[model samples]
Target chain A: MADIRSKIADIYSLEQLSLKKSWVHDRHPLVKLASTFLFIILVVSFDRYELARLAPFIFYPVILMALSETPWPIVLKRFALTLPFCLFAGISNVIFERKTAFILMGLNISVGVVSLFSIVFRAFLCVTAVLLLIAVTPMSRITAQLRRLHLPDIFVTLFEMLYRYIAVLLGEASTMYTAYMLRSTEFKGLQMRHMGSFAGQLLIRSYDRAERVYNAMKCRGYDSFAARGKKKRLSAADYLYLAATCLPLIALRIIDVRAAYSIVF
Target chain B: MIEIKNISVTYPDGTSAISDISLAIGDGESAALIGANGAGKTTLLLSIVGVLPAERGLISVDGIELGKKSLSEVRRRVGMVFQDPDDQLFMPLIYDDVAFGPRNLGLSEEAVEKRVDAALSSLGIAHLRDRSSLRLSGGEKRIAAIATVLAMEPTMMIFDEPTAFLDPKARRNLINLLRRLPHGKLIATHDLSFAEEVCPRAILLKNGRIFADGRTGELIRDDRLMDECGVEALR
Candidate 1:
């Protein structure tokens, strides 16, 4: 239960970082959102064997971390959470393909080894781009941008509600789990036999909570089409930031700095 | 003024919560709706906002009937503070929650900012404007919930179990705050002492009917009526 509580606290640490009044955080959310999307697309478009070319993309995360003043440990901790699936896929490639690609440390390295490294690198780049975006842009701002994009209200509202209540629901579930653990002395966790009632109770509680929330919303004159907070237009600096981010990403994808450097050296 | 005429509400499952209840609250008046658990206090309060459809009756606020067309306008005029502050304060930050109602009402940015600031400062929670709702203490959450509704500038206010989980100091503070508000207030509570302290008029509901209605002091002092209503005498 304490672990659940701490995890809930950790979920908001990035959001806390987003609140800081820095240049990156102060830029328009739509610009940040579009630039991040472009960066991820560019990073993922690399060829499977383009590990050397993908190396320069590390500058994006490094520069973003320095500019935003977000701690490296926090970003890396979250980045670690995305590694398992990439590791599994990479390991499979290493097992299936063994054709030699290069020699290093007096030993031949297989094409599979290179591809595995490429996959892991690509995953890291893509995850870092997204993490930096969210680390600097608040969720409300993101939703506001979604509204500006003419997305359907149901989708936007559902996203907002899910983000807001997920922690509360998780807290309720953890408290119930603690009570259950205290009751049965012999069991380590909730047993399969009691799963029916355990899950049913949570469902009923959530349903009742949803109804009460709807009533509260209705009492506040929230018709389905009620006006939301209008977002301000992007300033000249915001456009400059967007161009600075997107143009470099596009250039990096088209002309690999690694290829250019190797020929010059 | 608020008026309910023979309004009865029945759940879809055929359980009748309120049966032919008639009541009226004059302008600038405060009333306590006293009832035991499952005695329809919440249903009655919800009905006032047109949230729960009444099976048969008419509810009017200052001669404007509550129907499909007037519900939006009526809701704007009547603010409700729900039993659980968690349910009412859904926005990520306290400022947004306080601004939610006014924003929905299509207020301009300057006006919304003014109302939110005034509401928070009035509740003495101006310091919590940027804090998330999940991080607030129970008392702070309750105060923030009230500020959310107050920002809408409602003429009347309704509270459902406002002091359900407050500590003694917090309860006293809330009661004091309630005393200073000038709007017509209808507080549905099981707290007998609370009713006597804040309300001059009281209506007792039993089994979906009004069992008693009179001055709060006289009604709560009557041991026989208090016993019959299943509420404890003043403590």
Candidate 2:
């Protein structure tokens, strides 16, 4: 129950931060969205052995965080939630491919070790770029941008409703869990026998709630077609931000900065 | 004006929620639909806006019958407030929720903004325009929900259990707010005091039928009808 409450708090905290007014936050959502998408693609395009190349990508999130005035701890907390899968994949690479790639001082650096580091670094940069986009851009703006891009109205509305209702579903589940726990004694978790019924009940409740929500939307003149607010045009500063973000990432993808640094050494 | 003729709504399992009910509310008239749980207050309220499909009846708003072609137009003129504010408020922010109806109506951005502002200020919640809907207290959510409907500039407003889960102060404030609004209202509430204060007419429902319909003053004093509808008998 406490965990779910904190989860809700975490989501709201990010939402609160996105509401702050800053140069980065003020950039047109479409521009920020495109830049972040390009950033992820560039980060993941690197060769598996290019660990040093990904290090410079850290500057993107760092600069954006500094400009947006969003603290590091909040972004890192969300990043930590995504770390386990990357860690598992990287560890597998370390275990399988152990051929030595280089010799430094008295040590041999294996191919697997280099790839592992590169994988972890790529994960860090990619996740950070996505998080930075959300941390700076309000979700409503992003969905509006999606609609402007001619995405299917049904898909966009689904995306919006899913994001909006997640907190409500969590709250409902938490209340049900609390009620069940109160009726039981010394139970560390829900009994396996009760899991089926408990989950089924939650599903039924969610379905009923969705019906009511749809009716509410229908009552407000919402037809099956989606309607978005007026589009916000990109200002001169937004274009500058876009150029600053995309140009260097594309340049790094074309030229291996890591190999260049190694040659200098 | 709103009119219902011989309407009956049945569930898929063959249980009738609204059974052969007919009523009407003329221009600028307020009416209270009072009933106990399962007496079909919500079912009937939903039917007014063409949300619920009536198996055997016709509902017309301003002489436009409720059907596929007229549903959207009817919805634009008849705004409904659901029982749960969370359900009604699906947007991330209050401003968006309030602007939703007007935007759907194809209003210009400037007009939508103006209407949203007017609605929020009328509800005394202009300061909460940017606040997230999920974080609002119960009363604030209720007020925000009303604002969302009011922004549509509907000719008539329908609320299902408007005072559910409200504190005394919030309830009083809501009743006062409803009294001041110019649009006609058909409110379904168990709060007889709220009905007395805002609505001049009252309709009592029992077993999916209208048990009694009369002036609010005359109806509340009818001990037999009050008892039949499962509401408290006036002292």
Candidate 3:
């Protein structure tokens, strides 16, 4: 039913990144983003076979996610969406590989099983890191950070338009579905023949709203030249937090000399 | 020092939103364009502000042609307030929204701060300065919306339906609020009583053209013009 499909979309938006909470919530988005990226880069830098070493790094983001009060189920559901890549890269690593029996808990497991398991684990961590970065840091701040990092204005604008409109569009769709529900019984909503036209109407309405928003933005003099930055004078506390988190990470980066373990064996 | 020479706007669907609309307001005068809904009141304002970019018109703000070369200059001079306060007050807090315009024009922090405070105080919404714009009452939001534009210190102010959804008291308060503003303003509305009260001059916009322009009371007193333009005289 359209209701179910729409709820699914709402669920996607409701994860750690619902705009209602994300707009006013108190998570240090930039800090969480930095940590997420750092974890990914650190994990990727490890050899595929260095599962034992990578195990320790998992605690950092896991603890951060938990402490941040992010909804882990949504995070995991989003993480699940990345399985195709895992299936392709990971299962390929399994199916086309040489199988030599290895002992695990006194039972012999194939070499294919070991590599596949490692690939899935690696994929899971990668997906989770991406999800948490988005979840903790509302897309708006992330877009702002991208702008700060000199990303093209077009993509930044695109990101902004997408983030702002996804909620608005979902709301529009919900209204449409509600109207249908009130008018009909059973799965009488989204009649197969009318789905195309209904979706077309929804798109037109969303696009029209976007244009109106842009018009409204201009009327209120919303040129980019108006952006304000807090003279966020790095207080001693801010510096301390940055140093406490960043220095060790930089030191670790420098010390990651050989990556110690090799998967090419 | 604003001019509109033979402006006509037709939507892509081949409907004339506004046709042959030509009017001008002097430096120290307030003008109200009154018309019923769907009569191109907003479209005319949008044309003046260069938002819609009239298909055939020459709009000059303070005599600088509104084109690519002087867009920022012209836009900098013209401040606009939309119908809904929510659309205009896009910033998190009122101070930020009020400061938005001045900051964009690259005013110094001290200067912008001064403008923000002065504007908010002028609108008597200074106490709402630190509050989230979303949390403000509708009237407060509208005042903050106006304050955002007021802080810019523009040559002319345009209000697109300033009293679309306000109760009587709030509407009266806003009318009083507008009456107190010392700058030139153009209010587009269908509320004839509001027009007669807040504006000295009224322009009747019908099918996108200024069908009549005269003193507010005299203009509204013409029951034929009011009916023709779809504006009912409340008084």
lDDT of 3 at B65: 88
Instruction: Give the DockQ (2 decimals) of all models.
Output: 0.61, 0.59, 0.26
**What is the per-residue lDDT of model 1 for residues B1-235, given as tens digits with 9 covering 90 to 100?**
7899999999999999999999999878999999889989999999999989998999988778999999988888889999999899876578878887887787876898999999999989999998877678899999999999999988889999999999999999999999998989999998878888899999999989999999999998888898888888784
Question: Which portions of model 3 show Cα errors greater than 4 Å?
Answer: A1-39, A47-51, A58-145, A178-194, A220-247, A250-265, B91-99, B107-140
Across residues A169-207, which tens digit of lDDT does each residue of candidate 2 receive?
Answer: 887788889999998978887999999999999888877
Find the candidate with the highest DockQ and give its number. Answer: 1
Segments of candidate 1 deviating more than 4 angstroms: A1-3, A263-265, B62-64, B108-110
- Compared with the true structure, what per-residue lDDT tens digits does model 2 show for residues B1-235? 8899999999899988989899998878999999889999999999898888899989999888999999988998888999999898876578888988998887886898999999999889999998877668899999999999999988999999999999999998998899998888999998888888999999999989999998987887788888878888555
Evaluate fnat for each of the predicted models and list the values in order: 0.71, 0.73, 0.40
Instruction: Candidate 3: give its CA RMSD in angstroms.
Output: 6.2
Model 1 iRMS (Å) reads 2.4
User: Candidate 3: which docking quality band?
Assistant: acceptable
Between candidates 2 and 3, the one scoring higher on DockQ is 2
Question: Per-residue lDDT tens digits of candidate 3, residues A50-109?
Answer: 455555556555755665567778777767777777777767656766566467798766
lDDT of 3 by residue, B1-235 (tens): 6788988888889889998877888776788988888889899888887887788878998989888767777777788888877667654457767876776676776998999999999988889877665357788878888898889888888899899888888899999999988777889987878888889999988877788989998989888888898877665
Return whichever of 1 and 3 wins on DockQ.
Answer: 1
Docking class of 2: medium
lDDT, candidate 2, at B222: 83
